[model samples]
Target: MSVVIPVSADWLTLREPADAAARSHSLARRAARLVHPPAVVHDLGSGTGSMMRWLAPQLPAPQTWVLHDWNADLLAHAAAEPPASVSDVDSRVGHLEHLGADDLSGASLVVTSALLDVLSADEVEAIVAACVRAGAPALFALTVAGRVDIDPVDPGDRLFEAAFNDHQRRVAHGRRLLGPDAVAVAAELFRAAGWSVRTDASPWRLGGDPALVGEWLEGWLAAAVEERPALTEWADEYARTRAAQLAAGRLRVAVHHHDLLAWPA
Candidate 1:
């Protein structure tokens, strides 16, 4: 059995701005062009509805959105803060792997942000199949692309990055996650299913924002250390040095991600 990891509202709130900044606007515009009026959008792993808030305006008005997630609390938060541009919002609290064509029966567009990397290949296939069955275009955004560049580069950057990527791909609760390879796998599946696919880079360039940078640094290093326990001693020193650089406003990081948009050919 695969377990869903609980994501906190605070973390979502913290990353929302960066996510908004990093998403591909041209893809959003293209998605808008693909959908007809009075659109019904389904957002898988919607979280606190940040994706809805960010994307609603780009879509046609009088829109209805079904926000799907495993966390009921987050669903409530999403429902409470509906986007002004949407006509109605519905919340579905369930695992996305169980989603089927019927669940997205009337969808005009299917969307998700920062979600694909955490899903297994089976889960990704299920989503693609659901979209194909429903005849809806799909836009998967902000998937990690296995690249992280930090300015004033340290010798350990590649080491930690590799370990962190390994941790991301680690099997958990009997499921093997796709991690950074999510975009490639999803693109291949979509293309195999005869969909027209387009992908664009959506890297989060972090430098001036101390809060986001600091938090991201901590999480990145933590994951790296978790995967390679032998690096604990060196990671501690590295973390400290990074913290000082962050405080001095000298650290810059480009955490690479990719956005994929697929539509029936």
Candidate 2:
């Protein structure tokens, strides 16, 4: 069975601003130029419709959105909270791997956020192939590159980072996740299939949000300890120091990510 993590709407809402700022403006414009006057966008693994909320104003008006997610509640929330520029909203409840040309049939563009790293190589290939078959431009943003930086650096930072990445690469349900290696593989796969791909740095430079920092830090250390159980001995103290720094406004976080736009050559 897959070890899928359930994300609450509150968490999605909390991260929306950071996501909005980290997305590549140039790439979004390039995608917007693909279709004139109006566009039909299919967002894969859309969480609380943050992708739609971010991209709608950047593109032209009269847009239609089809949001896909495994959570029925998220789908309902997305459909109910259509952006002002959106002409209509449709929700599809399913896994990203099940996405196909048929699902993207009327879409002018495809988009997803913070999703690629958790997917297996085969799943990414399938999604790319489906996009190719559908003749749509795909913009995938905020894919983790397995790099993390925290202010007042601890000597154990690298250890935790490596452990976390190892955890990400773990196989579940017989599929090996690409983890931090996702960006390189995705770019190569798209290119080999005759798609022109452009990429931009979209790192999250986080500070001054203790709540977000605490939550993110908790998840980060949890995964690290899961991969390297030995880290558990040091985890509590490390997290305590980090949390104190964050509370005192002395913490800074830099999480490296990349945004890619793939289209027919």
Candidate 3:
């Protein structure tokens, strides 16, 4: 059995702004400099094509993007809202884990955002191997770094954080998700494969937006409770208190993440 985590278009839509803001522009510029014109960029786990919209302008013109995702609905949404700068867009519906060098061949760059952490170690290795074989540089962005800080701290914050991190690393359908360790693992793999890797902090400094923060808090607490059921009672209270703080404009959160760029050494 394969692990399947369903993602909604609403959730993707809600987070797109924050995702765009949190991405490392410096790293994106570096990636842009490395690629030649007429780029064929493959964005794995394309997720409504947010990565493409965010990155296409940074690259050269006459660009072609192959958006890869398993969800056809998301692909449809992506295809409908193609980036204006790109010359053409192609959608491939399938498991990105099954992708090989041949699939990525003729790619100038490979990219993904908020995707590495959800993948198992072996799956990540496969993607890295494919990138190497295709001789393509890669920019993997916004992978969670397993550290989150909420302002006006609560004692239960650490409790929920630990559990949530554990949940992120949980095994589903025989695959252990890499979670917070994803950036380090991927950097090591790229380096071992003779690729020069650079990583930058891309944490979301979330505040002033009640909807995004509240929704993120809800999901974060839910995952924590799911991982450690004993925290259910505590989570309820925590959620309520956080909601109150958010309403009062007192809640702030820094959800840490990393952006990694790798290229031939």
Clashes of each: 0, 0, 0
Report every candidate's CA lDDT. Answer: 0.93, 0.87, 0.93
Task: Give me the displacement of residue 63 in model 2, in angstroms.
Answer: 0.7
Q: In the order shown, what is each candidate's alpha-carbon RMSD?
A: 0.8, 1.3, 0.9
Give lDDT tens digits, candidate 2, residues 6-111: 7899999888888898899999999888866678999988879999999999888899998889898988887887889999998888887777799899779999
Q: Which prediction has more favorable TM-score, 1 or 2?
A: 1
Q: Which stretches of candidate 3 lie over 4 Å from their true place?
A: 1-3
How would the candidate models be sorted by lDDT, starting from the highest?
Answer: 1, 3, 2
lDDT, candidate 3, 130-175, per-residue tens: 9999999999999999999999899998999999999999998899
Q: Which portions of model 2 miss their true places by more than 4 Å?
A: 1-5
Candidate 1 per-residue C-alpha lDDT over 146-181 given as tens digits, one digit per residue, 9 for 90 to 100: 999999899999999999999999997888999999
Q: TM-scores of the models, in the given order?
A: 0.98, 0.96, 0.98
Clashes of 1: 0
**What is the full ranking by TM-score, best candidate first?**
1, 3, 2
lDDT (C-alpha) at residue 3 in model 3 = 32
Model 3 weakest 10-residue run by lDDT: 1-10
